[model samples]
Target: MRPVPAKAVTTSARKLADALRSGAQVVVLEVGREAGEGPEPRNSYLAGHLPGARFVSFEEDLVGPRTGSSGNSPLPRASGLQDRLRRWGVDDDSTVVVHTRQNPAVATRAWWTLRWAGVEDVRYLHGGLSGWRRIGGALDTDVPPPGAGSATVRPGSLPLLTAEEAGRLAASGHLIDARAAQAYRGDPDRTGTGHIPGAHSIPGADNFTGGELRDAAALTALYAAHLDGDEVGAYCGGGVSATTTVLALASLGVEAALYPGSWSAWITDPTRPIATGARPCGRTAAERPSAG
Candidate 1:
């Protein structure tokens, strides 16, 4: 692999297309939430996607138990992700490139999870599927048979912080709240979510200017404004969007721990404090989850 401008963050559509044509062990994955009114993403992929690309399940592949105390999309068990990767044709040496539709936030989840699972190289297509189309990269409607990958896998490649550990980091280090600015400020109408105490509001969407990720220098400078020598960490409504924060930091040669249980899990326990308003501060009282 030639040197990327930064770490495992960005990949060009041309490089990916060339890699596919060269028969490199490259697997492209289309990853994200289901769009408002299309066939399911798998069906969407069947309709059109990069050649040999597969659809990744947001619920089954990357996230774990939905009912657990751990938030909406908690991190999946290591074994679950390993199996998913294998079926996608990922091996120890396979280069996995992931892309998303509207935002790279979800795809960053795949990128972060693949790297955490110890894949040698993982990347996010810079402009996502739209980028591929913009570059005139061809798409195929044919779905390949399932791949047989026997790659050994493990977790812990990337640092993960539990809800408890994240609280500690927020108090002592940099903990970024990656959600809409309104939600970060605890807009009750949006949902019953709020920032953890001592967190800085930096929506993952803000990580990108226009529709693509910000350049590494800009990213580093953006983060540098709020941080000062403390280790960095991030969390969102669930754990998924937070990986974007991790990826953005990784590009700048900074390693950010992820709080997989994020605000979702944090809100589950009434004992856990919740903070609100523009600036984060200690919680006054635990708010109850709104009844449906």
Candidate 2:
């Protein structure tokens, strides 16, 4: 198998189209939230998606069952993910591209999860379906038959953080809280309010401009102070949005660890400290104000 290019974390729609046209062994997975309420949410992929792309459910394929106390979107069991990857036709050498029509966070979650499951050469679709449409990429409603894949899954390809590790990183290194500024500041009405003590608030949405990832120079500026060649980690409500921060850092050639059982899991233990306010002392970013 050919080696994946260093830092080939994202791909453009046009590039993907050309690759597909050339008969490159690529697996496109459309990640999206399930619509409607009730026990069974409607699959969003049924509406429309990129041609030859399989639907990866936000509620099902990407995460594990919640154990009440576990974070809402717990990392899916590795064995289960391996099975799904095979069903998606992901071979050891196949390049997997994930995209979403809703929040980019959903797509990032799939990217992060696939990496965690040890699938090399996984890339997120830059600008998502809209970007594909901009290039006149076609969408289809046909669900491709189950793929015949022999890829094996080995978890821990990427860095991960436990609750204790996250706490320690916050004190000694950069532990970015990737929730909204309002949520990070402790909205009383919200369920899981406030952030981990000593964490820096850098909302995941800030990583993008007009729904696409910011340029490398802009991202570097956005995270200049925190990426001082030191340990950096990110976490959000349930580790979903935080992947955006991790993805952004990856774009800069920075490997930031992710806390999968993030704030939701943190709050499960009353002993864990929660900080409320704009920014912790000595950890303020002028570019990130609390008023957002």
Candidate 3:
């Protein structure tokens, strides 16, 4: 019997194909946001996706309903997510692979969410649909029958941070603001203006090149300054893009927490400090004042 993959955070399309051929118990999820207006669910998955791949809505399944105080992308309810996971055929021993068309952030969001939900063997499909096509993997329009999975969702398998904790981490540890540089610098024209005071500006896009994650050495150098921080966390406009940073750090064997509420939630409370301009608060991670 072929051994099932274990502890891998990302899988290439070729490797995934081999695993499937070997009869590994794997569930492939094609996650993305709805497109176009109107009642019909228009998404790339509707056109075509990996054979046996299930569609997971980025807007619906991955996030909870927004409230006045909640961020734009609040974490979904665990029980609700559990039901959806089972419907998607995830089981206790299933090796779940998530992917999207081109946007790596969307796919990584699913990866992070599944990990947070305690799906033990979740992985991001590197290069997404394009990679699959490059490897001559077939796409199927037929939706497979709903799965019968006994997987239980226990949230917080991965580290998470609240607004307060994110703020504190920025001051003492390494808190990364993963929005674009303009947004991080509080461009007047951008939404969610400014960043959490003390957060470092490290756009999530930098982690990828040509729609794929950069090599580990590049990632290491990109994040070299903060790699040794006592603690590390990441946040973005609504908590969507920051997952890419978390994913990149994870690839380098670093466990950086996600600030799910992120900037959207931070700005809701006027009392929370917001910093603007190019400079981030404090210096390098080693220079940060110890939490006493």
Q: Residue 3 CA error for candidate 2 (Å)? A: 18
TM-score of each predicted structure versus truth: 0.90, 0.90, 0.90
Candidate 1: lDDT of 177? 91
Stronger candidate by lDDT (1 vs 3)? 3
lDDT by residue for model 3 over 1-292, one digit each (tens)?
Answer: 1112235688899999998889888899988774552354435676788988998888889999899878999999999999999999999878999988767898899999999998988888878888899999998899888888999999998889988899899888899999999888775333347777788899999998766788899999999999774799999998989999988888877888999988888888877766666888522233333555
lDDT of 2: 0.84
Candidate 1 lDDT score at position 78: 81
Provide the global lDDT of candidate 3 against the true structure.
0.84
| Per-model CA lDDT versus the true structure | 0.79, 0.84, 0.84
Candidate 2: give the clashing pairs: none
Clashes per candidate, residues 3 or more apart or on different chains: 0, 0, 0
Give me candidate 3's TM-score against the actual structure. 0.90
What candidate 1 gets wrong by more than 4 Å, as runs, is 1-6, 187-192, 286-292
